[model samples]
Target: MTLHEDACRVLKEWRAPDGAQARLRDTYLAHLDAYGDGVWRSRREGHITASALVADPARRRVLLTLHPKVGLWLQTGGHCEPGDATLADAALREAVEESGIAGLELLPEPVWLDRHDVRCGGPDAWSVHFDVEYLAVAAPDAAERISAESLDLRWFPYDALPDRTDDAVRALVARAAAALG
Candidate 1:
């Protein structure tokens, strides 16, 4: 199946944790139905983005990047690429690319969903990212290097996230820890 088909299949099978997430899932499906290119970043209406929280249980921390554009500490994620075969592949690719960590054990099922506005969706000045969030377990000695996409990359304790961190990231981390347990 194509990547867009894979997204539809994955979202259809996913069980949302709450009414809010269910609503977002439905909205994303609707967007996909209306635009064949909805999964790609080129879609101006909005697009499906994949994110992964990198958790190191040994360190009791999660890796976060200070996004250069958003200027907030956020999880590893971004717009899907042509090379991504599945939503999970996209999330894992983002995690590895942004964190400079290799061999991450990614959980295929999504742990959370977030919708946020951004500037990258062309000149319309109105674009939303239908973010599908996943979790990955990092090796005990995993090292992180900052990518150009981020101003800085750091591992923050689960209990002590950085100031101005989005609640979405915190929620993703909690959901990830629960999934890891």
Candidate 2:
């Protein structure tokens, strides 16, 4: 099956934790229903993006990258690529590419959904990203290297995320920790 079809099925079956998430889930489903190209970056209204929050198996800490453009300490995630077979695959690919940490295992399901406007790929490139967020567990001895996508990559304690992070990331961390326990 196509990745787009898988995404539609995933969102349709996802159990949103709150009314807010349910609404977003529905919106995502509707977007897909409305545009055959909904999952691609060319979708101006918004495009489906996939991302993952990487944490140690113990869940005590999370790996965050200092985004080159946004300059924010955030999780490893980004736009879906044609090579991706599913949203989860896209997120895993991005996490591995950005963190340089291989063999990371992704949670079977997504943990969060976030929609936000971005000024990525220079000035002319702008759009809202309907992000499907998942949690990935890194082995205890996993070594990380920084890629061109990030200025720095490091792990922060669950309760002590850096001040540069926003609520979306904080909420993802909280959800990821609970999922781990």
Clashes of each: 0, 0
RMSD of 1: 1.3
Model 2 lDDT per residue over 1-181, tens place: 8988999999998999999999999989988999888998877768999999999956499999998788789999998999999999999999999999999999889999998889755598778899999998999999999999899999999999999988999999999888887
Q: Which segments of candidate 2 are over 4 A away from where they belong? A: none
List all candidate RMSDs to the true structure. 1.3, 1.1
Worst 10 residues of 1 by lDDT: 119-128
Best by lDDT: 2
lDDT of 1 at 9: 96
lDDT of 2: 0.92
lDDT of 1: 0.91
- How high is the CA lDDT of each candidate model? 0.91, 0.92
RMSD of candidate 2 to the true fold? 1.1
